[model samples]
Target: MKRIIFFGLLFSFLGLKAQEQATISGELKKWHKVTLDFVGPEVSESDEFNPFFNYRLNVNFTHSESGKSYMVPGYFAADGDAANSSATSGQVWRVHFAPDEVGVWAYEVQFRKGKWVAVSDRDTPGVSGEFMDGAKGQFMIEASDKTGRDFRAKGRLDYVGGQYLQFQETKDYFLKQGPDAPENFLSYVDFDGTFHNDGHKDHLVKKWEAHLVDWKEGDPTWQGGKGKAIIGAMNYLAEKKLNSVSFLTMNIVGDDQNVFPYVDYDTYDRFDVSKLDQWEILFEHADRLGLFLHFKTMEMENQGLLDHGGVGAYTKLYYRELIARYSHHLALNWNMCEENGDWVKNHKTPPQFKYERLSMAGYFHDHDPYQHHIVIHNGNMFEDILGSNSMYTGLSIQTHHEDFHLVHPWVIEWRNKSVEAGKPWAIAVDEPGDAQHSLMPDKDDPSHDVARKNALWGGMMAGAWGLEWYFGYKHDHSDLTCEDYRSRDAFWDQCVIALDFFNSLPFWEMQPADQLIDNGNYVFAKPGEIYVVYFKTGEKSKLDLSAAQGELEGRWFNPRSGDYLKKTIKVKGGSSVELTGPKKDDDQDWTLLLTKK
Candidate 1:
């Protein structure tokens, strides 16, 4: 009888140990999201134990062959299936890691629980929670089978210096063009949140109804097809060949007050697990569609909402959660804040000083294992943040011109300024024009000639990485109410044409050399190898190729029609040559491409 009782106790202990083990899921392939789901302590989004602030989960993954190790932060997933089930309380805790190499990778889970443990110094391991705290395992990863427009096939998009972002595997340079407005994009009706019912501009929540037709049969949806419209919106952007999208992750007191990550509108420390899970679903689909995720963390108004504009507990936790959940994405940028430091000008919120900005960016730089591009949208004091010593990897330029005439020169100015500061920023004209009438609707301005010339081609020719169209509020399908992406369908075609032309060149190596042309046209060239001169108002101009030898061939490209004109010219290098546009409309914009023969 004693022996039988002892054996029963042993069996019970073995069963408990098996229940504590982690269940690894995902494709287990290179550049694929491999998730580690563990059965942790039972907790709720509203639990007094405060899972978000009092508990910390991090996993150290080390590749077997290369010895490359990454300490990835984990989060409290209310339920593993919360996106579909909307479960608020469960024992599930998860960490997602995208393995970059094809080999055996080992991981060790460090689960700690203490006072303010989530925001504590990561170097110190707090009190162990005892549930999967020291769990260790290994998994083998194979080459990704995904291809064509899938980010997994191209690998991570890394900012490897200079003006362009290059893929880790393909070594292809990326030039982004997409939408940058309707900052409340995440305030979808389908998301699990009370922001829609809250009295703060709840009506501004987006239904994205017009994009429902773009959602295919097999695309992801949460809570029984609740996310079709938003998912379909992403589909439409991808279908249009638009490669990036920007939206604010938090906008509590900002223009569109329907978006925030907390469980409640005013709650700052605690997060809504199910809502974030749903966001993850959308972000995962975006990865498959080859879309770059521009995570605009905060707007100007709410920049001072947390910790009174300081990097305190709430701010740290906010950035920590964001990095843990989304930094695994291959193509993304952590925009510190939109129109940051507006307090200096508007004096509404408290000023965010240079140290605070650096502190915030430094937090992301230290915590994020992937080290994705980090940038800040200007409000004022851009010069304060410039220099190689700073953490910012890029800039999101915003200009105040209705016609976007300043887009070209501003790109040049900042690009030169950043280089002069010993750090060259990957500049993009995110918000090109003024708030009143930038990029009017198809009904207001169907041709989009001004926007095409002064904004799109203007910034690109000035060596801007790309541009995101900001829909002005005065027009139909404005920024806040732009339900239909087709409102600016004609402009999208022009954007595609510009991207196709730029992608065909060795654009990464090319630098702006406007002095190469005698006229005041834009010149981007790879020295003697290739030169592209843009004539905003087409006319005959002289190009000085005096630095090169041998003959050169020239061709005229019609920017408006996306066509190569029959007009061609051949001229000897080491001399000034007169270049003329096609015999058609001489006043329209034209691009002259010259290549050494």
Candidate 2:
């Protein structure tokens, strides 16, 4: 009886194994054709590019029989690793599988040694088994229409060598640094210029203008209504060592340097000038006070400039004029739009919008006489284009709770690709949303820790440019008065707390991880000898990182309390360590600073 039962159980297990071994049949997807749109200053519209260029392409696929799912191998020829890989950085040929199967799958197409190929092994040690694993359960090789009835994936092959490394030329060309540049110009720490409290606003403006604020058109009275307002804002920023400001669309009105936009062309002309005199005064002030300026360029949502031909036209034209206009002034970055491109692409047809915006980017880069660090302020995470086969600058997303976690893997992927390309990359959370909004913008809220840290830690772990926090336009201006907008003085203090934490780390000593250590729960970064691990939830949590490194020494720093405790930390070789921080309920949660001697 026992033997019969044992045989029955063995046969049952075998039956399950047989069910899991289903093979998906489908034709290998191929490239339909190549499409490229070079959007320069002269070219306002889109066109076609002749292809069949000399480059390698790889096709990747995965599927399951049980209508469940599994992760198809990621494209990994360049870096030569798959499991701890991302599809964003390399040449991604998105396989459009027909949704004939009930399960899930992911396919990545990449270029390798001038030829396109496919693989299904993502793990470095190359492990393949049943598709029951959750991480590997997202792929199903069925139907997909990336370009219409196309069963295969399509992407252009790009030179993995020095040919593509020249995008750095664009960075250098656009962001050339003058001797007078601020200390942390590239750090991107800045003030909100739209505070409603006239006094606070004036304080901030004057504080910075005392040394900064170079302009090309209109007069921004440093002593008038505008001047007073600017002064308040600058003074506040200077008090805290925060000296850069990216003005929203409100910085200009036609030709005037006021806080609002012009009602018409006449209103705009009131402040208009071929040379912005007001900006000069402000620039001179900024220079004296040592402040940096980065105009948000234009607001795509409220102004509808892309279609109107005025504001958008002015944006492109102004960048050209401003670059030459303020070439001597130290500007930190050319922030393309206030979440314009993402909004359009996601809400509209992505392919069309992406192509159109790419043209705008090209135009901006080509026109800028001074090398500027250009960035796209994406309204959502779905539009991160830094991973495209073609080269572009880094990207930033306005993360609200709506999809905070949704962006981590993507960010990690882009970082990997950027590292391979040898280009500096960054992503920041610019919109924490609002209290009334579904995403909730409370920086002090503990519930938001998972979401916020997901963005901040993700960026840090992935070797991003830096992390940024937005306090909403309404909250920023709620304290409007004759003086600068109500002072969020303490708010800035907290910001410093966060930034100071970032400054303590070896900024240049890190790079994105080629792979992630999966502990069944949390993901960590292995930068050199340190295991930078981040836990998504729980107040006090301990992790077994013995699988991370052998004979590791550790110390932990409390980011919130500025407390550094040195204790002999250990995770035996091939084992993990157990550590803890405040519980999720503790608003005063902490960050563990792990290091080795």
The numbered model that scores best in TM-score is: 1
lDDT of each: 0.87, 0.37
Error of 2 at 213 (Å): 20
In terms of lDDT, which candidate is strongest?
1
| Residue 315 C-alpha lDDT in model 1 | 94
Q: State the lDDT of candidate 1 residue by residue for 148-259, as single tens digits.
A: 9899999998888777788999999899999997777898899998887889998888899999999999999988888999999999999999999888999998888888
lDDT tens digits, residues 287-352, model 2? 334344555555444333433423343344344334433433433455666566444554564343
With candidate 2 superimposed using the best TM-score fit, by how many Å does residue 186's alpha carbon deviate from the native?
A: 22
RMSD of 1: 3.0
Error of 1 at 557 (Å): 0.9
Error of 1 at 518 (Å): 3.9
Candidate 2 wrong stretches, greater than 4 Å: 1-229, 249-271, 287-292, 302-315, 342-355, 380-391, 402-410, 413-424, 434-462, 473-487, 511-528, 535-550, 566-568, 582-588
